[model samples]
Target chain A: MKLVGIAGTIEDHSYNRTLLKFMANHFSDQVDIEVLDIQDVPLFNQSDDQTDGAPVQYLKRKIEGADGVILATPEHNHTTTAAMKSVLEWLSFKIHPLAGKPVMIVGASYFDQGSSRAQLNLRQILESPGVDANVFPGNEFLLGNVRDAFDDQNNLKDDKTISFLSSTLKKFLTFVTTINDMNAKVAAADWESEDLGAHGHVDTTIDGLDMHAADWVDQATKKTNAVSGDTYVRLDCGVLTVDQLNYFLNSMPMELTYVDANNQFLYYNHQTDPENMSAKRAPAQVGNPIEDCHPKRAIPHVKQAVHILRSGQTDLFKLPVPSDGSKADMHYYQAMHDKDGNYAGINEFVLDILPIVKYYLGLTGQKLVKDPNATDALTGASKKSDDAKPDDVSGASANTDEAPAEKPAEEPKPDVDSVSGASANN
Target chain B: MQKFIAMVGTNSTNSTNRKLLTYIQRHFADKAEIELMEIKDLPLFNKPEDRKVPAVVTEMANKIDAADGVIISTPEYDHSAPAALMNALEWLSFHITPFIDKPVMIVGASYGALGTSRAQEHLRQILDAPELRARIMPSSEYFLAHSLQAFDDDGNLVDEQNIKKLDGLFADFQIFVKISDQLKNAHGANYEEVRNLDWNK
Candidate 1:
């Protein structure tokens, strides 16, 4: 394994530097350790970076080239020296050189407490999100009273300290090698494509349900109340009550939320079993701005999606919310349109379909028999049994009433199965 | 010294990623025999036609087959690898199978904050195709973000630390390649057996 030891202090007679040199010599057989001097590294400045200074760039490259880094620090004011901080600051420019880089920090000081405070401070800086340097989780090396610990030639005289440092270096070498081996093994594994055979057909079962049906029913019922003083709308087959409309939206075994064109939180279905829901929706959120309803981290993504939807560039956005284990919760957002083809709002649905997905992929012991009545169950055609036609569940004419007559809805095939197949192949 | 084939995924005339590859070649000049492989002359890969093998592709395959290791530097386009690079890889994957058990290292330079991390990931997936089977150097991903500021007018890496990093990667890569070569020889042409050998030892 190759390791680079960086002496944190720039002083000519620094104990930390001497200690690093001793380590390099001691571990010569197992590792090729090089002691890098940071004296030439310039104070980081954004303007200087524009010109691309040679010294700062060199420092960044050196750290990048190493398998692991050994930062031998010296204490000043109970913290890391200015030199160490300056090097870290330079490496953290637009590109983070230290991100995920395994690092080990050791400090040597004249005081009895050694440079423990400096090492602690350095660990915090290395772990900061911006730097993200992976410091060894435990086993700190603090050489206190360093003046008498080493011989005149800067060699370690203490047998106890030498043994401690040797064991730490050996463990550090193993850590570096293990990571390297794992990376090689992953790279060696063939993951580009797989023959999923007929497994790709499973995702096709859930395609093309009327995304706007629930909202359209709600709007049509509201208009009936305003015009005729009736709280229900008479449909083609039967009388549709306001309570039935609410039931239709909430009975889909998924969480539903709607945001208007003005980015307002209009409504969200209250889950009967709150504990089973992935995201909770409170009644107080109604009429609030969509931005306020989402956590701050998710606000930017929501705004971008809303902007894209309002522009009519694309009407659908699908994402998988990460879960604890192998299964992931799926979220789908579809843009709703008014009678004149004006953008109205968005309908968001979050569903946990891991069990269904697992069954289709043959991961579960269960078999997937094509549910002949799935289309009927999805379109509410099952509710109006008298008007239900076998062809009405075909998906070609389900949205004919709302969609323009010029463009008929295409047959909803199992598109997701093919997509999942492609992902499986990758 | 081992011979390595350095490939840049982009065919752009002034690609910074290509410049990065040239810098890497210079850095490893003392330790390895680095050769620059150009994909500009190769035609776009046609699945049916490439199965028969074109002369240019044949020559490129031969070069890869002869090299001890392969180093690729790529730029991300639309969150994936450039079409030109993918085309070449497809040809190599279908025809020669030069990457089978081969030692490969990936590096990238980009102007964006995420660098070419996404593209590198995409490339890793592609290289893992059953036919390619390239053994890539695992954990260390060299993403030189803000690459516009990473080099000087002379095309040398401005950051000395970055040069040292390249040096370290080359050192590890050399060892990895040597071990792979030893394993291949020991197994006596049984690719599967060689692949299954515990490489860490």
Candidate 2:
């Protein structure tokens, strides 16, 4: 199968285009690779019909002939490049060449953030419109510090980057072949028609956005709840779920965070009352590099946590609860896992049990005596108190077998970046 | 008077690398002319009816061909060079093998600690391709780290220490370009031999 790679630049010395050139040359023997030039293609507008035109004709021919297409592009403001969108627009007008077509988007940027947001956004856009894209769960070719990677002669000089790219290309090649074979079968024997009944139409009631984020959060909450079931918390990809996330935030006294596999900020719990922190912060920080948040000294520990989490390991890191004259120490238990039981990333759940400590210290339950000031309501604990420390908590069970009222424990607010229930494809 | 050219290629609107290049361009303004080439203007590549090329393509090719030496300020993406930058380089090659035995210096910067190391390595491999005739700066010579904050508000390399590394890298690149010119004038016997070997093999 022939695989075609397209680069999204028109410079005389674009490093990304050169990488495509090298890949083309490397794979020239096994596959016929062609470099696409978008120079002649007019700005994509549906009104301008170019069915028989030169640029559109070329694009259609390429898509029709090739088994798969490789798109290498630059991230522009956390979204797909205008040039790339133009190509899609052109395609969408005629044949929708991207629909169900297996494509791989790989590119570079100087930002250590690794263009994950841009790539994720592009992948979503591509898949949003009936287009199927093969997005790797993690970054496929995230090359940081591009400035030093090439020589003056406009060639890539990095070895490990090349090695990994070649390996990744190998996987892409396999996927393309498999996809091509499937397409061929569907076309030749009407296989898809026969199996149409088995795979019915997908329900589109919920926008793909909410469907995925919701699914992710639901799974995450279920997993966390399953562990001891005493703690109630919520995790989000970013700070978007403020109202729902705040339920968790106000309920818990500890800070919580949800990050993607690459450690991009998904969501962060806001410090309650905001008396000490900035009120309005950059939402873009939701997808910023995790390392940017910590001091240089803490990088090693963060890296270790990431490694352990990525390798399907759950780690419990404990910090002595701060003994600020009035508070008891706290414990931090971080559970990291993918929704499908794979290693997606990490979640930091901060539990401050200082109030519990206070309760445990004063180990006596007091009953109110009959007095004019002792109202009936004053004899029992308030609903909020019951919810805060339910009957399940140690030494907190009320006497008699009567089921206690279900109190609302504050759920850990979604991290500042979480868009839980959003599709992982993004 | 010796001629020199500085080219900035990046996709970011507020590119720190571009700002760095702007600083370097000002430095060269005293001795040479510098131009900033924006990749955003170029259209996507299409192979159908590959006929007359676009004007920007021709303009870019001409710039690279006429330049005495090329200094590239690249931005890293996804652990590699941005495909936009890579596409620009490919388009340049298609017009005229401006990369063959040409004096080229690659430098990059980013907000990250290691700079564009991944992109640097990726570019190194591309330049080292069997068909491409080019010289590469050693890893130690390539300066790129914490460069976003390295520049002053005036768009000058404010960090004296980093400026020193850039100075060293550019100085070596200058020498490489001069030597390359001499070889080009001398019929580039070594480059021809390499090309011939590649063709015959």
Model 1 CA lDDT for position A262: 55
Candidate 2 per-residue lDDT over residues A1-426, each given as its tens digit: 766677765445455676677778766766677878766666543334665688767876787667788777765434445466556656764456665567877776665644555565556556644245444334367655566766666556887777887788778877877876575444423311221111212221112222123243344445444332334344555433435546766565656666555455456576644343222223334434555554555454345434433432224433333334355433333546545445444566555466775554344333224456544232222232233122122112121111223343443333333443544453
Candidate 2 achieves a global lDDT of 0.55
Best by DockQ: 2
Can you write out model 1's per-residue Cα lDDT over A227-286, one digit (the tens) per residue?
333368787688867678677777878888876665555578876554657656666545
Reference-based lDDT, residue A283, model 1: 61
The local distance difference test score of each candidate is 0.67, 0.55
Return the TM-score for each candidate structure: 0.33, 0.37
Identify the candidate with maximal TM-score. Answer: 2
Candidate 2 is graded, for docking, as incorrect
Which parts of model 1 are misplaced by more than 4 Å?
A1-426, B185-201
For candidate 1, the per-residue lDDT at B185 reads 56
